[model samples]
Target: MKILITGGTGLIGRRLTLLLQKKGHQVVYLSRKKENIKDVIVYKWDISAGYIEPEALENIDYIVHLAGAGIADKRWTEERKQEIIDSRIQPIVLLKKYLQEKNNSIKGFISASGISCYGTDTGEARLDEHSLFGDDFLAYCCKLWEEETRNFTPARRTASIRTGVVLSREGGALPKMMLPVKWGVGSSFGDGRQWMSWIHIDDICQLYLQCIEDENITGPFNAVAPAPIRNAAFVATAAKVLKRPFWAPAVPAFVLKLLLGEMSAVLLGGNYIINKRMAEELSFNYQYPELETALQDLLK
Candidate 1:
């Protein structure tokens, strides 16, 4: 099988590409410019200019869309918010237009979404994919991002992985999280009771692989682990894994709001997101379901 991956340089994309190649599948990347990516071919696409390298679409079996602006990378000013939405949406529109123009069809379309689709602060309510869309900025952004995936009617199967805090040493939230823990000043955000739905990096990549290969999996699937830990417990587990003390006081919500602006929701707010469809409906096996074990593997 040959696959085309957008945002292939990202932490998950890079790891997923290697896994695909190991399974005897060919992987190509869509980038802003054709660069020398080790052991893979990169094709250029300028979403702003509305041009995608024609050869990139040649004989592609599936598309794994991981391209997007980082949600927590900056303060959510009106400009940054638009950027976050457009970054995710424009790529989809471009792909759909190109595929339609060439009359090309792929077997599946896998997209990246956020667990914040159910809002940043949903308290302890156990939310599923069928739950109401979130009302916050993050939820609004994810809603728009997933809606754009509907354009790919050519792909027989379309699915969106509503991802959570992906734990890995390479990138994403874990490294930044581990820093304070390593220094023995680890603490939780806000009141420390907000739920932090998380998953191991390998599990998420495998989820993406399943979406590509399995015909039964479709629509939005929560990409979270079985156990959803509270913010304080989540921090405590990290401290234990790093062999450090977890005695620091929780960061006040107001301080985070002031420091991060609206982007504070990524840390100061959360939901009890359930991976029902992915775990029960799909029966997907998790490589690291326990938080402590997952942290130990990444931190050790």
Candidate 2:
């Protein structure tokens, strides 16, 4: 199988590319970087203007849409919010148009959606693929991202993975969370009862592979671990794994709001998302279903 990936240089995309290559599948990257990679083909594009290199979409059997400006990279000013949306939407629109114009045949389209689809704070209710969209900036972003992905016509087989917080040592939230713990200043955010749905980096990559190979899997699937954990427990476990003190008082909600502005909502609370479709419908077993095992593998 030949795959075309947008944002192929990003944290998740980089790992996904390597995984596909190891499986003996051909991977082509749709990127602005002109430098040649050893086994991968690089195609250039100007995302803002909605232009892509002609050859990027050629001979592509699958499309993995992961290009987007980091949602937490900047304070959620109105401008930053728009960039986040456009960065995701424009790339898909460009690819869709090209595919339609050339009448190319694509077997499957797998996209990266967020668990934030269920909202910033979901309490104890385990949200699923059929759950209603959360009313917030992140929810709005994921909605639009998946909307474009689902609209890729001529390719009916599409999988929009609503992912949880990815625990990766190389990038994502794990390192940042471990930073303060390493300094003995780590503590939970606010009351620390907020539920956090998470998945290991390896598990997430394997899930994406499952989506590709399983033609029966389609639509929005909650790509989270089997068990959901609270923020306090999450911090406590990280400290234990790193062999650090978990004695700091919980950080006040007001402090987070003041520090991160609208983005503080992500830290102040989160939802408990379930990967029901992955388990029941697809019968895909998770590589790391528990937090301790996943954290130990990454942190220890």
Could you say which candidate leads in lDDT? Answer: 1
List of clashing residue pairs for candidate 2: none
Q: What's the residue-level lDDT of 146 in candidate 2?
A: 89
Q: Provide the overall lDDT of each model, using Cα atoms, as 2-decimal numbers.
A: 0.90, 0.87
Off by over 4 Å in 1: none
Q: Write the per-residue lDDT of candidate 1 for residues 66-117, one digit (tens) a residue.
A: 9998888888889998999999999999998899888989898999999999
The sequence of per-residue lDDT tens digits that candidate 2 reaches over residues 227-269 is 9899999999989888899999999999999999989998987
Using TM-score as the measure, which candidate wins?
1
lDDT (Cα) of model 2: 0.87
Write down the TM-score for model 1: 0.98
What's the true lDDT of residue 206 in model 2?
91
Ten-residue segment with the worst summed lDDT in candidate 1? 148-157
